[model samples]
Target: MRNKIRIPKRPVDTTMSKTTIPVFIYKPEILRTDRSLVVKNHTVKPVLRTLLFVLTLICITSAAGAQTAEELFNKGLESFKWQKSEEASEYFQQAAQADPNRDIYYLYLGIIYHQSGKLQEAEESYSRGIGLNGGERDRLLLNRGNLRTAVSDYDGASSDYSAVIDAGGPLSSSALLNRANMELNRSSFLLAVGDYTEYLVREPESPQKETIEELLNLLNTRLASDAQAAATAAEQALLEEERRLAEEAARAEEEARRAALMEEALQSLSSSGEDTKSISAGSENIREDFEDSALED
Candidate 1:
């Protein structure tokens, strides 16, 4: 009996969100110019006050419009935690642009983009963070792998998971499970079995332990059935070959028997011809003796 192994689908939540969503609320810092104006005359003092009020208004506007990169990232985080993905994405994009060197900014951007279902953008953001040598390299790879898997890029997803596993960290066990699922999707049952087994070993207390065990059992059963079928097919082929050889041997034996009978018949015919010639010679000698006796009389 064939057993069907049903691999579970990946959750829609971003990999970073699955780990933890930290909400950071930092006050935005605004840049303002402090200009010291000295009015020599009393008449110019009123004008200076008016000019100061205008400068204060301008500063307020600047403070409202311009936010520091850290502030934007914090806002993005808070928005993401609140499930405001669009708002979070905007803030993350702004933060990344303002502080291009910061890996965390791109990381959040990737997460937001992934949550928003913008796969291409999410991949680009993750790649950017990886290129920057982010401290959360494993997290980036995991998120990218998840995205790649969603898009049916099984090979790329496997590579990303393999990298995370090779790095050997807290996320390695998670990578193992994810890569196993991807392998299953690719119909690589043996590879999936190995990864699932390794993951279970590493994470004995994992929440997915029971489910993974069931899947492993099913896979094992399927593999055993396949092996049995292959063995049966090979045995059948061997029997057919034996039957064909036996038929050929039987035909050769029959041909040899027929050739022997033909040779025996030819030898008998040759012996009969020789006997007939001897009889003829005897008859001729008898006639000659009679003729000689008559002539003498």
Candidate 2:
């Protein structure tokens, strides 16, 4: 018999809260209960980045005034921690509406939507955030690009990543790392190498230094292999073409030789036939003269 753990429902808090977003935290289901659990080692995706900018929102609206946008955003984070994703999204949505100028509201909403598997909503949330015309466009672009990549929108994701790099900020290094990953997936080994090289240059102390180095080495080997394969293919094609041309030339020369032989044979046969005819004609004249002498006798 197997036992099932029931997740408890909690009331949503509408108060201002403070907690750091868990960048690499395990799934909530793991921490809930441990019972007859099959412990298996499975590969998980890595968390790319955390706050390049400190976000501190600890303001709650007074009873006399409406709830502040910061308070709503903080409340959304609290709901998210409690595993109340839908409620959290609502809070973030309200926060976004309350303050159209604040991009953080939309960023939170985007993250929540993305986690909830609402991919279209997630993308639109990021775009909406960017369209708000707020600060830290790089962060928004990075997040959006990651989302796009997750959904297999390679071209759109690539464009966003390139935009991040062109924007020129601390996150540009992260963007480079992401773009390298993109190129790697596409088997553009040399392009990936360039991106990885640039990422290392921009972030000398990158936390992923060892992993990046290993990947770079692997990519270098792959690039060499691919180049060798291409060269071999081209050489083979050239050889095949040369061989075909050589065969054609041989066939043409043989045909020409055959034609010349036939012409020479025909000329020899014609001359022989003409000499035989002249000899026959001389023999016939001698016969006629002998006949005339017999008649005189």
Candidate 3:
């Protein structure tokens, strides 16, 4: 037999002007009144053991067979709050299978997989959640973009970020920032600068404002230096072309001057030859006249 320990109820207070103060009575039920009595009650002990076993079996059966999706999701939340990731993952998976249309189940499952380093599964889960086109779409896209970035899939990450930006919501600024980072990874400095600037415009009071501003300043300085270098190279090329043209002109002028001098010398020699011919002819005529006079004498 069991023993019951009873606590007496409180009486009315005499000093409180006939006030009735209610007090709770505690009743404690003891399974054993004495150790020697329990040792003699072997039949009672077996019944108690059977009752505990049946209760535990019923609890397990109900949990495994009769729980709804919402109940499972709540249980998952409790496990997640306690940092029991594996247990939470099991519950979330069950919840998602039970109700495939619910976005939150897949969302939580994706987050759990991501934390567990199951990247492919996490990506698939996020994609499913995004396909539902619910309120968590931006969140899913953002997470998937981050996962793609981790795997060096810059193109996919950029696409996801661009989608989020085009949606034009609270996450647009974050999308801009993430896309800027992806562009930086791809070595697209100009694109990165544009995205970063847009992010700053959208989120003027962002917590990362100072850091982003410093990076932008450095990028601007580098771009300016590159522009100056390109301009200098173009100027040098133009100067080289001009120098080559000038040298060609000088050579042409010198050739023309030498050709004029040669023509003048040829003309002088021809005129002197004509004058000698005339002088020779006149001497011949004079000699002939002298010879005729000598013969007559």
Candidate 4:
């Protein structure tokens, strides 16, 4: 104000007055870059969350779909117990398909088939069950034996029953009784007696006393008849053997006697020849005639 000085005007593009406020720096590029980074983080977060949720759902579904073989087996048994034959068959078939290694499934299936009167199917099922494992083989054998007996297949029944006997356990008495019945039907008295005796031996003493006594009486009658027949056969065989031996001895003794007589004759002939050698020709002739007559007599 004391001395007014004229300030030079400067070009806007080149220079600024010292009194001018410094121009504010507008960093538009930095602001835009930070905003883009925020958007990227937000987008990625949602995608990652969606991926995790989908994975968890898949795991849950997979776990739910899994079921144990034994659980399915129990379901099949329940179906069978309700007398739903067709439904039971389907359940068992499924179980068997799921775990073909289990023999009990096949066994149950066989029983169902038999009850349904599907004999051939039942037989096949039982045969397959037996082939699978030995644990229930006795039951299969006993059932088959019963089937064979029903069909009058005595030989086959006998074979199966005998197998049950060899397998042993509580089924032994039933098998023995069945075998005896088969033998009785076939008129195999000796075999029937043997089986009946075995049954009696294995049976309990108290409850079956009267029944056993009756059976024993019948068995004893058959056994006595068999024993008498056996005795008669043995006696016949003995008589034939004795007759053969006696005939052989008589032939041997006759041969010995003939040999001794021939030897004595030869000795007598030799002595007579020596005595004749010292006699006159006519005396030798007479002695020869007398010796010939004596030999002839």
Q: lDDT tens digits, residues 1-297, model 3?
A: 554333344344242233333433333333455453333354545655555545434432346446778877887898799987876887788888889888888889999999999999999999999999988899899999999999999989998989999999899888889999888888788889999998889889999999999999988888889889999999999999999999999999999999999999999999999999999999999999999999999
Error of 3 at 173 (Å): 1.5
RMSD of each: 19.4, 12.9, 17.4, 28.4
Q: Comparing 2 and 3 by TM-score, which wins?
A: 2
Runs off by more than 4 Å, candidate 1: 1-66, 241-297
- Among the numbered candidates, top lDDT falls to 3
Clashing pairs in 3: none
Residue 290 in candidate 2 has what lDDT?
98
Q: Write the per-residue lDDT of candidate 2 for residues 230-260, one digit (tens) a residue.
A: 9999999999999999999999999999999
- Candidate 1 has an lDDT of 0.80
lDDT, candidate 1, 159-229, per-residue tens? 99999999998999999999999999988999999999999899999898999999999999998998899
Better of 1 and 3 by TM-score: 1
Q: Which stretches of candidate 4 lie over 4 Å from their true place?
A: 1-68, 205-209, 223-297
Q: Please tell me which model should have the higher lDDT, number 2 or number 3.
A: 3
> 38, model 1: CA deviation in Å?
55
Give the higher-TM-score candidate: 2 or 4. 2
Candidate 4: RMSD to truth = 28.4
Error of 4 at 123 (Å): 1.8
